[model samples]
Target: MNKYLLTIFTLFIAMSGFAESPDSTEIAIKEIEQSLQYQTGTIKLKEGHGTLIVPKGFHFLDQEQSKYVLSDLWGNPEDNTIIGMLFPIHVGVLDDHSWGFTISYDPMGYVKDDDANTINYDDLLASNKKDILAENQERLNSGYGTIELIGWASTPYYDSNKKVLHWAKEIKFDGDSANTLNYNLRVLGREGIYLVNAVASMDELPEVNKNLDQLIASVQFDNGYKYEDYTDGDQIASWTVGGLVAGKILAKTGFFAAILKFWKIIAVGIAGGFSFLWKKIRGRNENDTIEAPTKPIQEENDEDSTKS
Candidate 1:
């Protein structure tokens, strides 16, 4: 979601790094966690397309509770698109150290993986950084701070056998000391893909990495929708696995709404011209900027040629 005003109060907690919790807030948060009924074992994903096996030492929440926690407790905007969330069983959703996976699926048509092994990620990352740089002015124009793509937190990896692709990103928002971890996993299917994104601060990198394999294994599309079930004449996706990891898909699909953890934007302050201090639900409002005007700026830059 970029730095457009969607930082989780939970993220704020993580960034605060051991800030003492107010007794009332602490008790209220704990009561909220206790109030919900979390699920375990086999869980069906949105629209019965696939299934998520609540992996060992984790718990699952359906869309309702997930939205409440994300928008209400964590300070993310009201995103009705989320199918659910996954949390470590040991951690309270209110815990400062808490982190979880927000789940959603996109039927963007069958994704062909022929280019999987052919991509040069180093070159791709450079291109992505350029895209991010190009969008900063727009971010400022829309009342958000610039996003700094610090590079990959984990290099992209494709599992041909499993029909899944996963990667991690290191991102920094202006005016914040701590960086956000944007971990992404994509599961290809006959009609679309499942997006499993883990949102956390940089300090949780090791734990997230350690648990990724099993997490990737948790999502399984139903028989006819499985990647291997792609028959001739199926609707093909416009982008490939590389595009998913590059954040380009955000413009074309609803796949990775939280990729930048629009929930990661807490406060934004710009020096000259634009300044935004955000403190409320800010994720979905920023989603409007998805197809926001980057190319138009390129067209404006072409003014030099026009004058000549």
Candidate 2:
């Protein structure tokens, strides 16, 4: 009997320990929802994962052109606000070669040129000089071929094609790596994606590589996501240092389904487990209090019987 009672007590203690706590997912979701206010949609928290996707006109990027032109109650386009949809993002991949955009909140952690200079896609486009373009071409023809030029820029190859300026940057991974075709990115068209930024490194990061591919696959475009007039040039063998391209491209990449599945399981599981533990602890504490008074009453009755 004693052995049985001790075993039961141990089991109860273990369950109670788990029941008293909230999981990380539940706490994170609650905090995220409170921090971000949703205007027209809902916030769904998945188990074990801290991911949210606010699909409708949510600005994930917060650069200068990312503001929303909102109309007033009178329905006139008079009020402009910082509008954004919050999507569920996870650290599915990390390391270099994985493609992703810089969060408006993150100040560091991106690719730079050999001179340790950072490239801004917008600033570079606005600052390109005619003399610099000519000098770059001369070097390319002489077989020095050292300059890095992207498809959407005013480079000679892109300008020649004029109609297909939708092509973005081409990066050279390891010249020895077998996955060249897929890795050589042709931003397809300007209608499909927004070029955030690019970072580079020499480490072999499989998870980051996989996630980068996944991110690329998740890109899509809406009805207005088409590019009307643009130019393209012949493919350059290399990209010049300090050059960049950033724009809102079309969303043709297919990544939503995978992202959904991975995070949903994590968020739900964490929240559910935490809530269950909290209830169990409360119940155990109540039982202990109820038994306390009965023990004293039984002791008093035993003393009276012994005196009689």
Candidate 3:
């Protein structure tokens, strides 16, 4: 971690030519690394929902740490809805090649799986592409780069017995040389769905896809909240298997709002995140917005896309 900080700081100094206080840089880096507090073993989910048995070669950061990584390290706006994050042991959260699964649970209630087997993922993919095209004008109007839905890296698959749905999408942001990967997992519970989203570049698709099953097996709802525990009059989710597969996107604000989230990836790697780090290391006013350091844009994100 110290090495990573040093490397980034060295690059920061070289790029900006600011021989700023090394003491401050070292301290901030130490604080940020310590803030991660990555752990393994059994992790009890909040609200008695379930447990995450973090596998070997991986680490889990609880809500506070996850929020810090997302908002601070990743240069994203603060989002408290996230439950945690899962990362492999090999990479620091700040690594340019870093990728992780963000975990957030939505108590949207029991989602019936009657349509699980019937969903035509190819049709859904076509619809998603059209939606992206339809929304590109608004994105251009908003002075943001248009997003291209390149189709599924992994087609949607739902396991009715386990009440789980998962899929992956390959997306391209305007002007970017590389594409982004959005891998989603929905584990239905008696009262809600657990949303696990993998954020990475398409370069990591093989790795993310390889571990999908293991990651899926790690999260399990506690006894009463298990899928089979649904009762006669319990709350029900409006989404079905298809909706879960279409998780982060909507016909409405989905892709537009997701811009706030995905653009951070631009800053973190493609655009050089040194400015965000410099400000954090040097300290800043509380009211200042944490943006992706890319283009200046609106802050609305896919809160509904993730939590609702």
RMSD of each: 10.3, 24.8, 6.9
Between prediction 2 and prediction 3, the one with superior lDDT is 3
Writing each residue's lDDT as its tens digit, candidate 2 over 16-107 gives 43432336545644543344323323322221111223333332432221211011000111112212222224321111122223211111
TM-scores for all candidates? 0.74, 0.22, 0.75
Number of the candidate with higher TM-score, 1 or 2: 1
At residue 261, candidate 2 shows an lDDT of 24
- Which candidate should be chosen as best, given TM-score against the real structure? 3
Candidate achieving the largest lDDT: 3
lDDT of each: 0.63, 0.25, 0.65
Range of the 10 consecutive residues with the lowest summed lDDT in candidate 2: 299-308
Q: Tell me the spans in candidate 2 whose CA falls farther than 4 Å from its real position.
A: 1-34, 37-193, 197-207, 222-242, 245-308
Off by over 4 Å in 3: 1-15, 19-31, 137-143, 247-308
- lDDT leaderboard ranking: 3, 1, 2
